[model samples]
Target: LNAAPGWGTRLVAGAVVVTFMASYALFRDWERFGPLLLRHPTLLALDTLFGALLLVSAGPGSTLAYVSVCTPFLAGLIYGWRAAAVFASLQGLVLLLVHATLDNPHTGPAEALLLPGLCVVAGAAGSSLRQLMLRFTEATRALTEMRARLAVTEAVSAERARLAREMHDSVAKTLHGVALAADGLTRSAAAPDIDAARVRQQSGLVARSARRAAAESRELLADLRRESDPGHGTDVLAELAARTRDFHARTGLTATFRPTGGPAVPPVPPAVARQLLTIAAEAMENAHRHAGATRVEVLAGVHGGLLRISVHDDGRGLPPGTDLEQLRRTGHFGLIGMVERAASVGARIRVGRGTRTHGTEVRVDLPLAALTATTREA
Candidate 1:
């Protein structure tokens, strides 16, 4: 596997083998049929028989026995350092046995040492080649994965931008039309043919619906931007208070956030806190825009191992027998969205009159256990 793609390394290894073989022919009289045949026929027979070995490598091919160290060098390139070491060790053993069995067993040790030195160089080259190949594969794999993620991110961004443009063109235009209709109804409200009371009510409803739809659109856009982000440790009550102040600054309504329970409350999960804040904002907006409330109160704290959040306003309370599900049919989804938001965190929601004033009160209760379970599932 390592050798197949490395054309340069293969060519270099082949050249080294050929060079070694040429050197052997120069010094060892390799052109002769067999230098050892006349004086040591038994040695020649042993060499030939061992060269064709299947399980043990005593020497190289008969044509290049003097340069047999090249066998281990090539093996190093093909199978790395381990194979090189095995072949080199076997070659050394064979060299010792052949020289010892020859008539001139004491031939200078320097000539014998040259082959082992060449084998060491070959093994180092092979090991370096394998290391380079491994690095190339890993870098390629990382680059491919990064490209895939980049493509997905670009596609998602393009799609979201397209969707936002379409919604602004269609839904935004429709809401603007609703505002125009409400203005026209107000102008004609005092006419004799028009019942002023009914016209005012219809205008208020139209204006409120337009505002609610616009708010939902803005929240949808915000959610889209934040969808892929991970959660963080945020103080739920502090964040709610910040949002409350932001809401007042945006809508010019009197909004206040205050914690009810003591500081012993465990930190609320980010998901649960987000839903609670969204629901509270919707309730406060409902009171300010539709219920004609000047003051809205937001409370968040822990009670009975549950995260308790309540939004109360000094405005006319909900109508008798108000059904949350039916609010969508009447084109008033503010309350309905609040309920859904609370439910998303496995919380209970209730809408009723405030205990201290003649106004609406919205309470959301999120049990810690239920919120934890929902967070896990999500």
Candidate 2:
């Protein structure tokens, strides 16, 4: 017998016992006792010693003698074939002993051997059932473990993608600017009539760009090591204004930051603010590198219970048929990252022509309720 059976195993055993009891009631002539055993089959099944006594009293030729076979079958289910064989043997010995004591002339050699044979067969059948149950249990456990492993793999892949987007947006963009400044410096040095003051200024711009790139790289590493949000306690509008100034300094393009409908941008969660800042910076970078724009403007404001941030440039607008799918095919993930960042904080992003219907505009709109809800969840 199992020392401690699980609920599943117990359920299987109970179902078997119920089936056996129903068969006994249908076939045997219990008369008065039939109703009692049928009413409480649990008593008959659980009390094995009492069942054995009933077998002894019923004698070898009695129909009730077949009920003794259930003992070995139950043994097989709980303790395997070896124990089933032992119980079957013990049941046979009890029947032979009862036959000798009673001296029933009608109980011949064939009758004595038939019931014992049936007991052995029942034990084998129960053992086979047990093996099937064990296999089912093992398969279920393996499937559950496999699903857990798959979930972990997916989580790791997502984290890697997030890190790639961070590198592309911050360190990679800054380094690209640094390269442009270095190239400018090299050309200025090679010029025969190089102005001394302009050369010094170009050299300073290159140095500043390099330092900024290094700082961004170090910050990325620090964020990884700390495993915490890097945007906590940051001023969103101030950072955007600073990035706009830096863009102008590096690219010598006219970049401006403006707050419309208010003197200051409305307060938002630090993490949401950080994502907005990054999105705006990416739009500026695109304008400088791809649009050939001379001027760029960043606008921020709260209107009608919505926070809206927009970047506009005076360069040629986005090419026709330029969508996220086409950008992905071309290995450009900056806009994809911006969309994902906006989605993370319950915002909607739109990329199209600027307010003046010239150049391009990237705008993000977020509901004030969503911002408050996200803050509460965090």
Task: Give the TM-score (vs. native) of candidate 1.
Answer: 0.38
Residues 83-188, model 1: lDDT tens digits: 6676666666665555444455456677556655665676667667777888899898556444433433343345456658867875687688787877778677
Window of ten residues with lowest summed lDDT in model 1 = 52-61
Off by over 4 Å in 2: 1-233
Candidate 2 residue lDDT tens string, 1-378: 211358655654564467568667744766766566446645434555555555455455555577678777866766678867877787777766666677567778887788878888988987888888899998985664444334333333454467669889978988898888889888998999998898899889888888988988887776444323323434566888899999999999999998765434445555556677889999999999999999999988877666788999999988898999999999999889998877665577999994677899999876655544433333
Which runs of model 1 end up more than 4 angstroms from their true locations?
Answer: 1-231, 372-378
What does candidate 1 score in Cα RMSD to the true structure?
24.0
Query: Against the true structure, what is every candidate's RMSD?
Result: 24.0, 19.8
Q: Model 1, residue 136: what's the lDDT?
A: 95
lDDT of each: 0.64, 0.72
